[model samples]
Target: MGSCIICGTPVEGRICDSHQEDVVFEFRGNEASQLTPGRFYSGAVDGYADFGVFVDLAPGVTGLLHRSELDRRLESLDWEPGDTVFVQVKNVRDNGNIDLGWSIRQSERDFRGALVQDADGDHEDDESDESDDAEAEVETPTVRHGSASRDESDESNESNESGKSNESNESGKSNESNESRHQRDEAEPEPSADRERVEIGTLGDRVGEEVRIEGEVVSAQQTGGPTVFEVRDETGVVDAAAFVEAGVRAYPDVDVGSVVRLDGEIELRHNEIQVETEALVSLEGDDADTVQSRLDDALRGRARPDEVTPLADHDAIVSVGTQLQDAAEEIRRAVFESRPIIVRHTTTADGYVAGAAVERAVLPLIREEHAKSDAEYHYFDRRPLEEAVYGMDAATNDVTRMLQDRDRHGEKLPLVLLVGTGATVESSDGLDLLSIYGAKRVVADAAAVDAEIEESTDVLVSPVLADADASDLSTGALVANLAAAVNDDVRSDLRHLPAVSYWEDAPQAYLDAASDAGYDETYVRELREAIALEAYYQSYEDKRELITDLLFDNGVTPDGDGENAGNLASHVSEQFRLKLDAEVETARANLESREADGVDFAVLDTDAYTHRFDFPPTALLLDELHRREREGDTFVTIGVAMDELYLRSTADVDLRAVAEAAREHAPEAGITAVGIREGRIEFLSGRREQVKEAVVEAVAEQLA
Candidate 1:
């Protein structure tokens, strides 16, 4: 069914529009145009071209023309699918398809003159080439030559005859048009002849250089000579050595996926490019490298340090499965000459796969090695990790210092931290809890902890939770909670794993915690205000208890624990605020109505309150104003829920600006402040005061 153009409502007559005609076009090619030209229409471009034009003019009748014919120019001339263009009919080709000619380029002479010059120059060049070839053939082949071997007597006679002819030709030397004849005699420039080509390999006698070698990156470390990359590109492995500019510089930040290109002086001892790396370039594409780098920076313990820096003594990197055990051995050997001892777990297939990538595998190594051994882990519900150390001066500052210290010992570094979504860790010292060492750690809350368990290999388990019901939640939650509980339940016997938790955004809880821990009320308020401001721009309803309960209010839900009763108070407060805002908006709109129409209105008939009530002094003045503004018959337009006073007058009120202001002020208020057109003033849905204020503002701005 056809709908109204602007509002998309069902149309009855001419679609209540101001436009003169509907835009349409002729169909061409594979697509058929459904509308007529010069009318508003909507469709997609089936095909277009490079010369600032599109081909298929009408759906089935394809043509070409400049886009300027459509009265608009493209910002970027590059064409792609989904771009729209407009055009008008130009010419109809003999092949039935319209030839959409475009003269958007100013002056027809400009194009015609340029084409003529090009054609003339080409013709002359072609004629000159032909004459040169003719002259060359006539001068060289037609002259008679005397040969000695044929006959000496005949040769002597021929030479004597030629000498006589040369003397006779001297008599005809001065000819007419000598310059033209000389030009004709010039030889044609011949094309170059073909030559045999030689292969690059034939130029050099190379031994090991001819051998194609590939190796996977085991470790990029310098063992005895220059920086060496131990890669296994698979064709029996190779240690392609890059020396100085080639070796050390090529693989500065080398990782597992780095593909090394080795074409240098090769030694045949091991069947690999064994001379120190001569030239190394990372084979990783820019996009892949960028994404991996960012992810790694966020999760690692330090920002990228020098590839050879002894950041930490090669320690045992915890991993699971045989695949990781092999990887860990490679990693540890590269980091510390010894192979890293692998800590295997009975991991699921998915778990083993998720941790297979180098990105996820390196984080726990950095975290366990970096964090303080005695770092206390607290397990509590509601507060984020950052808030847990909110007021602890020394601890908070230390965490913040480490977070902000991107450079360690003058070298930039990133910290690797494993975290989940919605789990923010803010340092008080202005350091981002997320270090650029690896992936940004965003630990999701208890509800959405499934992602965490599916990601890590060396799953840290809490000794305290050794007796807890791990089966109470999904595998994801079990992992997340176990991590959380281990980090949280720090006591004498359970001090191995650190704890992590925060109270929900009930500013009062933070304040209480601070006060009980010896913080003053003022300090508590400052922190409370900081947290409360997070919700200021949100709508009142968003803060309602009912909404929060259905959404975020459940910081940690108890499985099978039925309805949550804590949301009742928040729900009531939200309702109260919503009602208050509505009432305020209604009162203001009523006052605005009377002010705009030059009337001091008062209610006389309660039932007709939505209407003009009674003909009081204010109502009468409003009528007079309406008479001064409208251009058609004066009457009331009534609907089931609303009433509008419409009138036709011949006077000028010029309240356009006033009405616009009213609409802007109380968008949700039912009363709308309106300007009298022709001369009548009227009010739509809001309170009078708001309408009056808008009208006054509109008038002031107009006059100014």
Candidate 2:
């Protein structure tokens, strides 16, 4: 038994099974059965197919590397036939069919050791023989186009090799290690004439050709093998790998957001083009300014649309459309810059529908901007808040996650988005936290916002600030407009969301738009109820696929188009009605009648009489209860829990003014208004009885 080269542990081969993936292999066998899974092997592109590509491991042996096994799109690959590449053998079936997977490490020099494999057995590579016939397909040194000619470099290397000690020459060790040579070479800048600068997007076509690339380092990640730098130019981004030692960071001076010029040879790694870096240096002066200007101009042209096209004919929405366009541009810019987005919304139907609509639109844009298929998940996130308040806990959680990501993956700070929330004074502290860390904050709400909120947020798109009627729009309706502006391809899918958002009276234009989009009134209503019910159970989870299915991708339903399957929304809506009816009935049984200041009040002790955590919460139950208790001309329904109470009134209710007046009546109750739109107030539970009565009297007197 030999010792594993990596950890010095005993193994059956030169590399232990645990560390086998770290070692790459050269296959000499002519049969597929001799190939071992989990170890990477050198291969050449035989050809492509509709489903995948065929990689030739040997003269007569080949393996199928399916398109799904790739980290990037199949069409994006620029490899011509007979190009040397690397892939892992995933499986060798009984029928002699071989399956290959992607390998992140493309070059044999990147691994600590390269092993030789054959039908006989596995052994270490013997580089001294240098047999052209036996290993006819051995690696060829990539030629640097404009640098020292191949003849000169070979002569210089041979002279240096001849001067080396006899022991070092026989052992096959170089005079200078690759890392020290790379460090020395990178210390000096080469003349611009030595290499032609190339755009990152064109690197795929220039594989094995040495060139210089200039761009900003967007991300610098360190792996077990190499330090990978993601450089973004105006056209696109490409990974540049630099190696000093195993698990050691290369070019530590080069960091994220730095504009640098990288000199390297292009190679295909895992079907995606990567740069094997020889030298990387930061660019400054006119060159840096030129690159920065080009990137900014390109970003503005590609990320921002000229104008916002409202899906429906609504004057109120149009009046505030420009601001929505600005918010959309910011969101698009974040995606292009490879920044993560945290979309926080309330746990209501309007919040879920709004978040889902924006999510659907943003996801496709992420896929288009990034080469990786799973970039959508890494770039875009939708988090639901338990309440509308974005407090310390939420902001702290966001900070913790962002810091961890930055340290581990060299990612940029995320953009914190508040949809249908973060417009109140309650959200100020959270916004402050995000601002301190330079995280962009956006508030796209339809409710009246505190004056302080507008000044603090990066982008605040609200009817309250736009001088329009806030009552005419629901949060979902307003944010759906924003979602459409983010991605116009998804505009048709969001037409019915506005109609679905309204519980009672929706704007006629939105209703007409939903009808035009083939969603009848009944269907939208059922969908709204279903989202409301589902959104409540998992109040914190994103439930991305489930929401997508309900909104767009659910299979053929009985009431929906095509052959009959089943309508998921209608079945879920049925439960919504049943549960809501039960809660409202229970609330009505404990209702107390009160008459003061010419107002009739229907009050219920929520903590003592109703289910706390179940469906049809205080707000929904009180809404239904107030609609039923129409015994008087002016009626008010109040649900009082241990420390909080909800108010719904037929009369005008100014929550802030009522809160100030209520605090006066109960001086030590410590009462405050949580949500102005919802008429929610919180107080000391020890003084609940006095606080509830005080609020009722204060509100009644304000209207009286």
Candidate 3:
């Protein structure tokens, strides 16, 4: 029996079965089957392949280290042929193929002990000879007692041999101990003051050279090999990879948004400049405060515009500049903190255009802020709602997704941005649900805002509340300005989007801005028609990338076919006009024109006259039909449904006033203004005929 080297427990060999894995072994077997599974072995690099590397364990035995087992990218490996490495034996296949897994520690000194595994599946510790010598010494006393003075010269010879064996074992152990200590010392890097501090933007000039940098950590993630910290200084952001112990987290205290001082060498990683951090320390006390202040100052100077610039020369836009600034700041802070931003917009051409503009501006910022290439997709999302109201259904879906992301990925709660939606009283309940979980809400809609909605959201940008004509502005125009405030770089790209939202009669200022940005009138018209057609097909999807291309990309393809931008728009717009014309003709033929309560009324049973499941939606169809029918007459067009009604008027009409009158006139029917800006009303389905009669009379009285 012998004592285990690690735990000092008695065992059959120098180490117990439990401690076998703790010790690394030098394999001396000549066959692959001689190696034990789940044991670490010392090997030398035989060669490399696109899929994996080949490691030689013995003279003629080798194993394949598949690329999937690698901690980092296969190409990042610096190992050369014949270089000593450590790998774990994962399996020995039935066909004698050896599979090797990656090991963090490449040196035998990193393990508790070293052993030699023979071809017979037996382990021999390097110190086993010393233990044998000690046993001989113990028995020598017994021999002396048995034969007091007999064979003293033989005993002396035996004692000398034992002493030499012990000396050899002690010397080997000492060398291993020294090597381990040296490796540990080398792993801990000391910060040097002699290194010059450089901005991240200037790292291109310092590649392959040592550098010192101080910045705020934008994000941090632990990969198998190192903890990658994305630090943003005044100039720009760069990734710093700090590896203390391979596959172990280093600088455990450094977190996202923390101010840190790092010393490292700049190396090109995957063709991008990255700092392989040698020393990383989180600043504390006055140092931390100073670094934070410096970052804040720089962010303010760069992120915030000198003054709020209105997109158009309008009183309402000028008045809402402060609110726009607040919305922009919230978005910028979310990006800095690595919180996901969720945009909720109505499923309309104007709404999609508005959301896509913001998506374009914010995605670039997310990419710049995160080290991972897929960060933009993970951190920013846009969901389209079927209606212009943020109801319980939309709120429930948002909360579910946010909770899932938070639990599964440890993501921060997102910022819920309601673009071209959520400015009505009906959306307050949905906004409140988001607030219960500490999600920030911002509303940017060119709609008549309700007082309750302004209170429910953190920031509300509604020009109608500032006495602006809601009819003169499109939601796309309003949110395009908000997107510009969030990211100034995309401001020019969004110049044409606002004008494209209007089917006709866009504001002169927006048209001029679009022209200045090189989008002619014909281009704007085609883009608008394309978006309108696309919005009707997949009313739920945001179509983020495709819409961005159609709206912003120049009309030139790599093949020079001039079929990139306007090609899709031209084809889709033709379908839109044809389908819409057919629907309008059907609706007009079914229209019942009459005079009710001294008012001209145009009423149509939309459920029977229009294709509810195809082409333009009920709200959009009513809007166009009303605009074309009510040329000079001050009339009200009503698209009546079983349980709801969509209204359009030549003169300004208050749907809420009509809803209140209908409730009184038809006491048994429950009526409410579901979409105020859309001029929509909902009533109990059971009281359909009674509610219709009451609603027509009430609207006529209000118009009168």
Cα-based lDDT for every prediction: 0.28, 0.76, 0.73
Error of 3 at 268 (Å): 2.5
lDDT of predicted model 3: 0.73
lDDT of 2 by residue, 1-704 (tens): 87554445667876777557755677999899889888888899999997888999999899999976775546657678999888999999999999999775554433434567888777754541242132224232222331222222121111100001111222355434576546534554443557778887787699889889888888876543345677888777776766543233456567889889888877765465777777778878998998899889989998887889887887778878888988998898888788888999988888998899889789888776654444676678899987777888998999988886675457889988898778888889889999999999989888857767977799999877777877778889989989999999999899888988888789989889988988888888888888988888867778776677688754124322345667788888899999998888887888999988889888999999889888977777787788888565678889899999999888778888888999999999999998775778999999999998899899889889
Model 3: which ten-residue window has the lowest total lDDT? Answer: 158-167
Candidate 3 per-residue C-alpha lDDT over 532-645 given as tens digits, one digit per residue, 9 for 90 to 100: 878877677666655765776653222223334336666666788888889999999999998876778888898889888888888888888888888455688899888899
Q: CA lDDT of 614 in candidate 2? A: 89
- Against the hidden true structure, what lDDT does model 1 obtain? 0.28
Best by lDDT: 2
At residue 31, candidate 3 shows an lDDT of 88
Model 3 stretches with alpha carbons more than 4 Å out: 1-196, 243-252, 336-339, 363-375, 403-411, 469-471, 515-522, 554-566, 631-633
- Model 1 compared with the native: what TM-score? 0.18
**Highest-TM-score candidate:** 2
Query: By the lDDT metric, which is better: model 1 or model 2?
Result: 2
For candidate 2, the clash count comes to 0
lDDT of 1 by residue, 1-704 (tens): 34322122344521223221211221322432322233322223455554445544434444555544432333233445444433445545455554343322221101100100121111112332443354346432211111111122111111000001110122343222445334322321111223221222221233434333322354443211123344442112334433221001123445445543433334432131243333334445663465345434432322222122111111111111222222233332222211122111112111111111222233233233211111011000011121211123423433443333221111112212222222112221222322222312222122222222323322222211223332122222222222222222211111110110111222233234334444345432322222222222221212222222222222222222344434332344354344334433332344222222333222112123333231211222333333333333222211111223222222222344445564677554443322121122355544544544554445444433
| Cα TM-score per model | 0.18, 0.73, 0.69
Q: Candidate 1 at residue 636, lDDT?
A: 20
Once all C-alphas are superposed, what RMSD does model 2 give against the true structure? 10.6
